[model samples]
Target: MQNRALAAATFSFVVAQSLCGTLADADWPQWRGPSRNGHSPDTGLMESWPDGGPKQLWIYKNAGKGYAGPAISQGALYTMGTQGEKSTLISLDANTGKERWTTEIGDILGNGWGDGPRGTPSVDGDRVYAMNGGGHLVCASTQDGSILWHKSMSEFGGKTPNWGYTESVVVDGDKILATPGGEKGTVIALNKETGSLIWQSSDITDNAHYSTMVPANIQGQWQYVQRTEKSIFGIHAENGSVLWKTDFPGRTAVIPTPIVFGNRVYVTAGYGTGCKAVEINEKMEVKELYSNRLMKNHHGGAIQVGGHVFGYSDGVGWLCQDLESGEEVWSEKRALGKGAIGMADGKLICVDEGSGKVMLIDASTEGFKEHGSFTLDPQSEIRASRGKIWTHPVVINGKLYLRDQDLVYCYQVQ
Candidate 1:
């Protein structure tokens, strides 16, 4: 009876975890943290960094070459990288800078800007999903880094973008979503357990660009929001039906993930194109709220803290803009160079692209109030002359993770 009772309890625990996602509030298992918004729910973090920055906990110098950011779940960190002509999905110890395992996803991408993978890996309870530069999507065992199922997004007719596919697969419940951008069907949903075709958003087909898709619940309508070079759209999360779309004049690349607040969605791009915000109505339609160049965030995605948005713009440096009014609250070019940013505990954690500097700033709408800053030491020499620090800094479990080409640095930000 005792053994039977123990077995029953174990079964119940596994079932509960599978249904609840088993992801802690502080675990960042997906694209831009828990909510895919570049924000962390962690508190009690340092209000400001010291003169030199937070304490560097440990550094893993063999992370290979890639711009993929690290995602953490259950004390394990997952990221994609490249070694020689092969691309790999790496699993690392979140507390110590030690590699647990690596699964080679596919061939290397030799982009002139940089070579290797571009999208971060998404971690679920016991499995991880990653997409390679050439559009190969792989589902692997998080325990041993063994590939379970691998397929090219091109199979769905997604022609790889010129710069290659930079999308991280989105996993929801039993369906795993991927963008194979072309004509057949842009966004395809596969069975997470079997990698079988579930559905495709055929109603509105736009070729995949560099941006990752974000799941949304607008007016209680479940859908996925995404952007292409020429347009912005949302499709029903249940049946892959086209909900709504709007014309977006995005130039060069549409790389930043769409930011959703309430029923409104905000998107921005680079190469001269600007930003726009649209409201989703009761009938699942869109209404443009405002469009401007106040924040032309390139790949360093922006974050909306409180009621304001913050990011490093092209012509401008760091910027703070009002979310609802679309007004520029303040802009600063001196605090740091062009950089990527993450947010936690009402403070903006940022990294400079050119100088490889990490900074902590107040996420207030008042002004660009920098609290502290530091430079990433021994930066990558393998990067192109124009290639700077492109990896977005990630903060999870009171530790900050930053990566250059082949180097991954972990810092204790608590």
Candidate 2:
């Protein structure tokens, strides 16, 4: 009897362990991926794609109109789009691309490029957060798309930018951080669970641009680093106090999120404005290390791999630059048109916005070398006349997700 009891107990324990392992989430829960650095934690991906690109497993139509990316967590995918007369939050099964739920968040934003949300939905545990282009912010339940709490950026003195609110709010710890740029504050931290105000950064009163905030621990001090059209600054994550401020000659639009490497912060912009790097010490002192036009990344987003930064410069084409020295490593101008980029498994997956062409290349400092390239078929006929395939490439859990207006294609990449 004692031997039988021991065997049963061991069997139950093993079953529980197996269940937990299967349910564990491998997710890209927010904009710019899990770390907001455009890097994927996934490994064992295809080092080189087949001639026609990775096999397309499924295609999800009716994602609606938006440049927003998808956020995958807990087996569900979340994104924003215009469902009808209103901007809507959408949830779908990550594996099968089946519609789960949709919740209207705000009025549809009208733009020449397209009409829809610009920010990706951010998923946090059982809740998800999204900001429509109309400056309306909503926190919704991840399961049924029920709105938990909702707030507008206008309540915090935020004026919608000319292109609309394109920020993907950062949910750090117990607080949700957002930029509602005005005289009242440039940044605000709200209670994630209740949607109440915590604190606001009142010192820097700059107008909000399209960039998102990145959290960094500098010399043991945790803060949120953000960039505006005129400045790059850091605010204390706890009280929203201004920690450091530096000048950036950003013009036209500053659309890329600031990249924080060690104690150094790097920012880039488009429309003739270039890139710059600044170092912040423990004492909160700021010093500019280098500034140049080597990386005039428009809105495609930039990623840092080791000590080098890679992105598509407006006129310079796709290039790699040393993060610290600001020296150009290598550039390829004629290979691909201007587009967004993402990284996975030590490789770069780049998409050309003009033609919906996808390319897989080695993320190497030696030079630009293409591993594989293919153009997206059945491109959207409803895309704005001015809008190309503007959405960035996202790779997670062996699947590659790409969007062209209402069409969301899933390809097996592992």
Candidate 3:
């Protein structure tokens, strides 16, 4: 009887351990969360902020400056910044905000807009991927921040964009995809383990811009969609074949990544440019459904939830537009000035650009409903002379993560 009881307890322990492992694997492993659409599968998050906003759990001052955001996975947070002239990648303990390790990858390049690294580090399983403004792509180990492999975009026949490599590397299956923007090809897929070029998109060569690659299945086929200065192209994810192309009259700069929903794609850019919704047919043909300047989302990417797309539309203010017709449902320029935004539990988390105030609003088509607002007190040292809060806010596992240059503040949203 005693032996049987002990056997039953051991079996239950093994089952519970396996369940926890599976849950941890479902975390936000890379940029834009698990789906690369800025949506977190994390539930049980605080639906409303406290009166003065949730308590700041901790702040790590070692993180340098630039607009790069934090990538959380396996109990660790990865982000990039610059100290002096060298660009460094730092990893931190997600629960305690303690430094795990830091690695100097390359030199820092500055533009009129900002400085340091502008792209988020992608944490893939055992490897952490980061890109510097100087066009250096480094893949390091998650355990100790040791360099696994490194490659330069310029050396691989890609030119650095005006604002640097702001596109976060996308890891799909065994390959990592990036836009180098040169003669080799606009998009290239590299072996995630060995860092060798597996394939490059054929001669649709155009200069790289600020957008990241988004993976989606359109009409039962897997495709990688990206927007460049010239046009938007959907490439076959398996072999990098140009599936379809649509000309976008983007002016000055094209920064935001295209949002894909089913067979339709929505794209937007700032600086007098506008937004458009395009449909992809079964034969790989592109047709514009609606094009308008109503929601000119600058560099901040919009999210499609329910039936409306929510984002800050350049000079038009924070707006929600119909997913099919491109009609504005509501515009709230008076509520929150111009800035980037993200969605958490069906709520719009808006970060004001001019000021460091974060606002929570209802993500609805009815109108703008402000729930709570608070200024990010005790800002980072590196953010003293920097531009507005440029990094998009991220919410995961009931925690709110915001960045100002190198400093990252983690708050308990629940």
Best by TM-score: 2
Q: Which stretches of candidate 1 lie over 4 Å from their true place?
A: 1-25
Please provide, for model 2 over 1-414, each residue's C-alpha lDDT reduced to its tens digit, 9 standing for 90 to 100: 899999999999999999656544788999989899999888889989999999998788887898889999988889888778899999999889999999999899999989899999899999999998888989999989999999999999999999899999999999999998999999999999999999989988899999999999987899999989999998999899999999998887899989999999999999999999999988999999999998999999999999999999989999999998999999999999999999999999999999899999889999999999889988887899888898899998889999998888889999
| Segments in model 3 whose C-alpha atoms lie over 4 Å from true places | 1-26, 384-386
Measured against the true structure, the TM-scores of the candidates, in listed sequence, are 0.93, 0.95, 0.94
Clashes per candidate (backbone, < 3 Å): 4, 0, 3
Give each prediction's root-mean-square deviation over alpha carbons: 5.2, 2.7, 2.4
Superposed by TM-score, candidate 1 places the C-alpha of residue 17 at a distance from the truth, in angstroms, of: 19
Query: In model 2, what is the error at residue 284, expressed in angstroms?
Result: 0.6
Cα TM-score of candidate 1: 0.93
* Candidate 1 lDDT, 354-411, residue by residue in tens: 8898888888877878789899987887886667788998888889999998899999
Q: If the candidates were sorted by their lDDT against the true structure, best first, what order would they fall in?
A: 2, 1, 3
